[model samples]
Target: MDIIRIEQLEIFAYHGCNEEEKRDGQKFYVDANLYTDVMTPGLSDDLEDTVNYAKACKFINKFLTENRFDLIEAVAEQTTRALLKEFPKITKVDFTINKPNAPIKLPFGNVAVSVSREWHKAYLSIGSNIGDKEGYLNQAVDMLYDDENCKVGAISKFIQTKPYGPVEQDDFLNGCVEIETLYSPQELLKAVNAIEAAANRTREIHWGPRTLDVDIVLYDDEIVADSNLFIPHREMHKREFVLEPLVQIAPYAINPISKKTAEQLLDELRGQSENVNSGCAGCQGCAMRK
Candidate 1:
């Protein structure tokens, strides 16, 4: 990764908590470090392969001048998000906004807000066992696409698989989705849960049945274990329903816990299944395989 630094670009903007500061306006200093691959541009001397810092400076100035916010935190966050969205080559941004004229009685050099934001790769296991399973799955995908904070990447072919757990239920139409999202792990969870709720999913019975089920299978190379969510999904590797479709789209995607590829995980699960019951009659002819 290469860095493109824009240092101390000063602009006058009306952003402050105090009414006087907002009305009169104050000087705001912005510093940004854009992370991207600049090797090709450097070697080829092609402007197309790299970002134009001049244009970026102008954009920042124009944006800040046009937008008004009560807090510099908001300014920094909005600016970084806008920059990342506008420049496809920029992978990450380390941004800062300094307000030297903050309304404070005590003498202080400056008050600043610094933020870092980037797009994160994530994989999801989505399925539905009741009521237009395929339609429910497609609806989920569409919701993800419509979200401004998320970008849909590769989607695997859906496979019908027998349900797990003790609950008696119909087979599920299962598949995996690859996405690049700006939301953090928790925020992504909330977003997906909202989508599920919109589809009328219920949790009255544990693993019973639902109109839709979406689970975060992976998030970049992160290993997250919190009270609410777990990354690399606790039992993903053990389930053929998850690994099969996941391997189709992200075969080389590594599970941080086991450090094994999706393809390898699928193979290991199949091997274990073979050892337990070699060529089970139930699996001989399945619609999921088609």
Candidate 2:
């Protein structure tokens, strides 16, 4: 990844823990390094293809003057987030805010804070078995696209399947999504839940009928099991509904535990699962029902 460097832009702001530092204000030097695809701008010679350094500088200046903070770390963190929010093209950024005049008892050159952040690619599984099945599924896709931080990529055709557990309900429309997002796993989960809630999903029964159901299948090769969620979902392999749609977008995608591709898992599942396929194409009575 190429970098756009802004070395030591000087600014005088009132950001410090000391009374004098805030009252009289001090010279705070800021350095920002934006990370993204600079090759496009270099080849196309288009300003829009890259982040506008001049505008970024102005943004840093305006944000510092607008907000009041007590520490240089806070200033640096907020600045990084502001830059990312303002410029959609920036994938990652490293920024440092310098306080040259520290009121410490020792003579020092400067005290600064630096931090970095970036986006990650994630895959999600969505299913709905209740009212407006197709509607809930499509709406979830639309909502993911609406988010600025989320880049909704390839989506698979929805396939219908029987209910997974004891709950008796209508068939479900299930599929997978390839998403690029700037949110962490926890943050992304919140966003997906919001989308589900917008579809009027309720968690009344386990593996039950839901207006919309969304699960984070993979987050950049991470393995996690937390209080609210789990990655490489514990039960993905056993469900043909999840596997078929996943195979559509990513046939070679693997299960973190079994170390098998989605296609491989689907093949194994076809032999054991009760109802596998939803009847492919024109098959009058297909056995591969999910």
Error of 2 at 226 (Å): 2.4
User: In model 2, where do residues sit more than 4 Å from their true spots?
Assistant: 16-24, 40-48, 102-107, 252-261, 271-290
* Residue-wise C-alpha lDDT for candidate 1, range 1-290, written one tens digit per residue: 79999999999999888889778998999999999988999999999989999999999999999999988889999999889888888889999998887888998999899999999999999999999999999999999999988889999999999998999999999999999988899999999999899899999999899999999999999999999999979999889999999999999999998999999999988977885686554453554676
TM-scores for all candidates?
0.92, 0.79
RMSD of each: 5.6, 6.1
Q: What is candidate 2's local distance difference test score?
A: 0.85
Per-residue error for 81 in candidate 1, Å, reads 1.5
Clashing pairs in 2: 275-289, 276-289, 276-290, 277-288, 277-289, 277-290
* Per-residue lDDT of candidate 2, residues 222-282 (tens digit): 7888998898888888888888898999888777777888899988888554343553443
